[model samples]
Target: MRNFNKNALNGKRAIITGGGGLLGPHHAIALVEAGASVTLVDINEKGLKRAKTKILKVNDSAKIATQILDITNLNAVEKFEALQTKHDTNFDILINNAAVNPKMSEIGGQNSGRIEDYNLNQWNNEINVGLTGAFICSRVFGSRMAEKNKGVIINISSDLAVRAPDQRVYSPSESFDDIKSYKPLGYSVVKTALIGMTRYLAEYWGHKNVRVNALLPGGVFNKQPEELVRNVSKRTLLGRWANLNEYEDAIVFLASDSSAYMTGQSLIMDGGRSVV
Candidate 1:
């Protein structure tokens, strides 16, 4: 039996895309706690500042860096990669976590919840940020990892990747016709596509000792409306949504040698929502 060291990532470096979002800082904190230096990449400069502040508040000595870059632009990403190389910073882990998720509050009116009314621009934007961005980052960062013959790539998918969104949860009232919001088609499509990407990359980089996988996390409770929370809770076996930091340990496990033998797999961390 091999002994698992909690500090297995002591000197490892990681790069997390979408590092300015709600969960991005949490993921960075987890890695830093496990002894890894982290660089967070996102287009939202303000959000990146907030994420860094949040992480530093937890651990003043945490090794965290933030960069504002559009992941959809291949040239931009390549430039960022060149800069990191110039600094002699080779990332040992890459977390494809950046995405544009449309909330219920952001939907309705011209942005109708109905599929037929979905705007083309919205679809393209979401797909570009959530899907294309992931591809570009993997191409730039993962390829470098392959050159070194060791790395891990984790695609942050959603539980919706495995199961379709239960549209009822978006309904403001008990009546089905009262659905004021929806989980956009692009959201699910992007997440589902990530699964396929994970499989392909895992195999493509396996010989190079680069392991790739996806983390399909369920909804996190973030001050959503009471009714929405109730509806989502009813569908989940755990009877509630996940807390903000719930996925941190899983992120650390995937990024570290703890999951050494795991590859090309989707690790679903929904509150048993998919099962029920």
Candidate 2:
């Protein structure tokens, strides 16, 4: 049996964007467990509080901080710098996990509509939050990492980054023709762009020892409608949606020294969905 040291990230300082989302808190818990001080940033104040609460529940002694900021704004650069100073961390790791992703329950039922009906404002907003926001965070935070010659960036992408969304998964039946609504094009486009940026930065910063990589995670089970869950589960080789804890180790590995030799890569944890 191989003995893996879970505390491989001792004394590390990490930052996670979109730390208020469904999987964001889980990412924080994983990094905290690995012995890293975490700063969770998000635009949603309530969500940020909830996420921090969850993390505290898991590890009472965990060194955690919460910040509310919009990553796409130019002001984020200053705020990020201030966060590093306030936390007194040189920023050993950055998880670019923020994005405008709507849940299955939010689709059709919420303000979301079909692609043909997707508002121009909505499109630009998603791009700004998902792609441009990532670039802003990377530019401000990653530049410091490059200068220090040490850091890791884990860009959280989706299975759609590689393959187009199976529109059938959103329909009541597995029929594409009868689709009443569809996953917005902006979501897939932004995620794919992140992968490209990941590769570009990996090479751009390789000489500086600032490793960059992307994690393509599949749909996580988050109390969505049963039919939608079943639809996606059948499409996946794993036969079920991913539990929140499933990707913890992968996130930790990418953030820690475990992936020291790896960069410019997309680690797909979609339960073989991309192959099919």
What Cα-based lDDT does every candidate model obtain? 0.90, 0.87
Each candidate's TM vs. the true structure? 0.97, 0.95
Candidate 1 Cα outliers beyond 4 Å, as residue runs: 1-6
TM-score of 1: 0.97
lDDT of 2 at 212: 97
TM-score of 2: 0.95
Model 1: per-residue lDDT, tens digit, 177-222? 8787777899999999999999999999999999999999999999
| Model 1: pairs clashing at backbone N, Cα or C within 3 Å | none
